[model samples]
Target: MTRAVAVELRGVSCEYRTRTGRVLAVEKLSMQASDREFVALLGPSGCGKSTLLKMVAGLVPATAGEVLVYGRPVVRPLESLGMVFQSPVLLRWRTVINNVLFPAEATGRRDAAMRERAMALLRLVGLTGFEDKYPHELSGGMAQRVSLARALLLEPTLLLMDEPFGALDALTREEMGIELLRIWQEQPKTILFVTHSISESVLLADRVIVMTPRPGRVAAEITIDLPRPRSGRMRVLPRFGELVSVLQDEMGIAT
Candidate 1:
């Protein structure tokens, strides 16, 4: 079965003008993600991984070349995509359910059905009773779960996640990865995830796009052949270590 392409970047480059001069963050980088595929942008800091996500979301304009989503050119911010950043970025005053429904409310789509969907999403992320709580009342992991739920409120077909678990402790980070996979299985979406962890890239992604530093480009594209519905037990597998080692070498890490 041939899967449809969800995102395609043709010779895409992104540049920014600093006070010093022009800084090329990404240069002639091209990549694509298939429909409902989980693709991770795996690279070190300053590699423009997050920049690529912004271009796909139309938050940043490509300095050269084209970005296409679902076979259409992306000229403006896409309405059919959801984004979750490093921080949960929840409104302090608003309760969990309100934060989740904020998108629908802002777009004038908020109503009974939308509210019901928000509750269901909260439940999906295992935050059923915490809907009435404020951001300050929740722990780091719980806050991120709420962020995940909010991102899924409208059920967008594409999800752009920028190290959503990067801020948590090691144990919590591991827990969230498992939780994310569970949620994804239940509600599948084409996910373009950005991360710097080699093990995380191997664990969460169907394919890892290892990138060069600074003026980012694809260093390598590695397909993860691990069986799906992945668990922590798989992390101890020899194949898993091999895949992680491959990513490390691509990043020039002495592993």
Candidate 2:
């Protein structure tokens, strides 16, 4: 069977109509992702990584060219895609399973069957026994797990993550990275993640697409050949360090 195209950006660009003047955030950016591939966007702060992600999500209109998902033009927010941001953003009042069910209710997918699936997702994210607990009772990592489960509640074919683990401390972030990889392996999806950390990109992505400074464009595409089921010790491997170094250099980040 031929591989499918999960996402395709053809000379896509996004410009903002700001108070001072029109700002071009991304310019002539083009890329392609195969089905179930995990691609990360790494760059400096002002390089418009978020803008590119939003455009692909159909949350931002491309000022030029096209953004396509599964060969369909992205004209609006796509229901087939799931998004997880830096913050968990869970409603404090909602219980763990209820938070995961929020998307189902909002999208009119609520039903007995949907509720069962939500419960399954909560278990997948390791929240099996915390179904009735509120967000306040969860740790930072646990809250993010809820966010991830909520994102996957609809079983979206494409997952867009904007620094989903960026808010956690060093140790928690590492644990979440491992957890995310495990979840992705168990349930495959095309993922587009944006992160400032080069090591994080090397650790999680199949390929890292580095962006240039303002008016961002693809500066480099680094393929990660590391072995799968990556362990924490992989971070200390020579090849891992090399991949991280390449990403850092592309992003102009000091080593």
Query: Whose TM-score is greatest here?
Result: 1
Q: Which candidate should be chosen as best, given lDDT against the real structure? A: 1
lDDT of each: 0.93, 0.92
Residue-level lDDT tens digits of model 1 in 104-219 = 99999999999999999988888999889999999999999999988898889999999999999988988889888998898889999999988888999999999999899999
Which stretches in model 1 have alpha-carbon errors above 4 Å?
Answer: none
The true-versus-predicted C-alpha distance at residue 153 of model 1, in Å, is 0.8
Which whole-number lDDT from 0 to 100 does residue 89 have in model 1? 98
Looking at model 1, residue 202 earns an lDDT score of 91
Model 2, poorest ten-residue lDDT window? 246-255
For residue 199, give model 2's deviation from the true position in Å.
0.5
